[model samples]
Target: MLKGKKIVITGASSGLGLMTAMKLVQQGARVAITGRNESKLQAAVQSVPHAGRLSTYVLDVTDAEAAAKTLDRIWREMDGVDVLVNNAGFGYFERFIDAPLEHFEQMMDTNYMGVVRCTKAVLPQMLRRGSGQIVNIASIAGKLGTPKSTGYSASKHALLGFTNALRQEMRGTGIIVSAVNPGPFESPFFQTADPGGTYVSSVQSLMMKPERVADAVVKAIVKRKAEIDLPGWAALGVKLYHLFPRLSDRIAGGMLNKK
Candidate 1:
């Protein structure tokens, strides 16, 4: 379905971003992948199936000016951007009091503002063409504030809100705005979120694989889903939250306690 499409995926160096890029390339999409690390981005270029169809750009989404320039360059080079996957984000697991104020800034900058800047960069073209897709990779954390994720949760919640509002605003514009809210997955996410390696140990076996989430993302784009949650069961918690707030908090707390 992605044949001849030009897609840009931020944070495509490793983990879920890389996997999703690979999946799109295999399906004949021309993918421009961005990352802060040149080495990791190059490695991802080599690992995908259609190497000739892949482009790599060194982009730090936290840098608003740089992100805008890079996105503009990619769009011009590709002639147009058919899809934009805003997947660049990171998180930390820590007690709110222990997490430095800078850490919260990092979360909001990269996770929330990154999406804002990149989306703005692509808007003119998408709006002019009257056709496009913007995919925001959010998390289940956005739905329920899990323990040790105060900053991370807040950023994702903001992203989710942004995605919802953007989708509604573009309702008659022929643009697709969707958010993928995946549960904890077996990716480098935990390694980055819990650099000390203490939290990932307990739920190692339960973590879903990156490929699973990638497949879901691909499917969502094809179907033009407004929002989706991976692992199916994970969506139930979100539903429960709307039905019973206090009970939902207890449920989320219980899951975090296991980690």
Candidate 2:
């Protein structure tokens, strides 16, 4: 469905972002992927056939000005962006006090404002063209905050709100805004998030592969679904929590207690 489409995916140096780019390229899309690491970005495009269809830009989503400027330059080079995947973000688990304020600041900048900046960078053009796609890689953390994920969860929660609000504002326009909330996925996330390895190791059995999550994201873009929770069951739990907050809190507390 994406053949010949001009698409951009941020955070494509590794994990789900890279997997999503690979999948889209396989579907014959012209992909312009961005990352903070230029070498890794170059290496990503090295193995693909029709490599001419893929381009790389070194970007840090936290820098709104740079993100806007780069996207503008890429817009001219690519002709125009038909789809944009906002996937640049990471987090570290910490006791709210153990981590310095910078940790939370970085998370908000990369996770929430990053989406805001990128969307603004491309939205005007999309609205003028009257059609486009914006896919945000949020998490189940957005739906329900987990212990040790205070900073991470807040950022995602803010992202979810931004997405929903933007979706409403874009009503009657041809632009489609969607958020994909995935559960824990197997990736290098823990290497950065924990560095110590113990927490990641304990939860390895519960993690889904990046490729599977990427598949769901691509499908959501094609179908223009508003919100999707990976694994499906997690989505159910999120809804139930909203409907039964008090009960959910007790149940959630019990579950954490057991662990």
Candidate 3:
């Protein structure tokens, strides 16, 4: 479904972004990947099968002006951008009181504002073209909050809201906006969490693989789905929580206490 389409992915150095890039390439998409680490980006391109169709850009999504400049360059080189996957984000799993203010700021800047910056940079062109797809890699935390993940949850929640609003506003524009909220994925996310924060030790076995999430992204883009949550059971659980907040909070509190 992505044949000959120009797609740009952020945080493409490793993990979910890298996996998604490979998947998209295999499906015949021309990919432009961005990361702060040049060596990692080079290595990622080498690892993909159609390395010729993959281009790398060293960019920090937190820098709004720099992100816009980089996007402009990419659009010029790629001819036009057909899809944008906003997957650049990090997490700090610590209690609200224990987490530093800087950590919260970093999470908001990268996870939430990063998406905003990239979307704004590309929206004018997409709107003019009247065809584009935006896939946001949010998390289950965005749907149901957990202890010691206040900032991460908040950032994702913001992304979710933005995606919803964008989708509504672009209803008849032929521009697609969707979000994927996946359960614990077996990516580097946990290991990359702030060193000072307390990480979730339990439910490790329940984590899905990064490839699963990447596959879901491709499906969402192809189908132009409004939103998706991986592992049908996980999606059901999140919905149930939304329906019964008091019960959900009690269960979540218990899980945290047990940990």
Candidate 4:
């Protein structure tokens, strides 16, 4: 479905971003990837089969102005972006009190504001063309908070809210806004979390692979779905938690207490 399309993905150095880039390229999409690590980005490009169809930009999404400029330059070179995957984000598994203010600020900046910056940079072009799609890689934590993930969860929740508001504002415009909330994915995300984070190693055992999450992202883009939550059980859990707050709290409390 993505054949001949130009797609840009952030955080494409590794993990789900890299996986999605590979998949999209395999399906005949010209992919542009951005990452803070230049070497890693180059390595990722080489690892893909049709490396010729890919371009890499070294960017830190937290820097709004830089990201905007880079996006403009990329669009000029690529002729315009047909799909945008805002996949750049970080996670921290620490209690609210123990987590430094800077950590929270960084989380908000990269996870929430990064989306805002990238979306704003691309929106004018998309609106001008009257056709585009944005796929935000949010998390299940965006829907329901879990222990030791206060800042990460808050940032994701804010992102989901922003996506919803933008979707409403873009109504009648040909642009499509969608978010994908995946359950824990087996990636470097957890290992990259705050060093003093609280999540145990066993927790990582249940995570799905990056390829699994990438497939869901491709589906969302192809179908233009409004929102998606992976692992049906996780989606159901979010709804159930909302409906039974007290019980949910107790259950969550028990889970945390075990740690």
- Candidate that would win on TM-score: 1
What are the Cα lDDT values of the candidates?
0.90, 0.88, 0.89, 0.89
Positional deviation of residue 194's Cα in model 3 after best superposition, in angstroms:
6.7
What is the C-alpha lDDT profile of model 1 across 169-209, one tens digit per residue?
Answer: 99999999999999888888777798877777777776788
257 Cα displacement, candidate 1 (Å): 2.5
Residue 174, model 2: Cα distance from true site in angstroms: 0.5
User: By summed lDDT, which 10 consecutive residues of candidate 1 come out lowest?
Assistant: 250-259
Candidate 3 lDDT, tens digit per residue, 53-156? 89999999999999999999999999999999999999978779988899989999999999999999998999999999899999888987877789999999
Judged by whole-model lDDT over C-alpha atoms, candidate 1 comes out at 0.90
List the pairs of residues colliding in candidate 3. Answer: none
- CA deviation > 4 Å runs, candidate 4: 194-200, 256-259
C-alpha displacement of 161 in model 3, angstroms?
A: 0.7
TM-score of each prediction = 0.96, 0.95, 0.95, 0.96
- Tens-place lDDT per residue, model 4, 146-254, is 7778899999999999999999988999999999999877777867673543454546565687888999999999999999998888898899888998998887766
Which regions in candidate 3 have their CA more than 4 angstroms from the true location?
194-201, 256-259
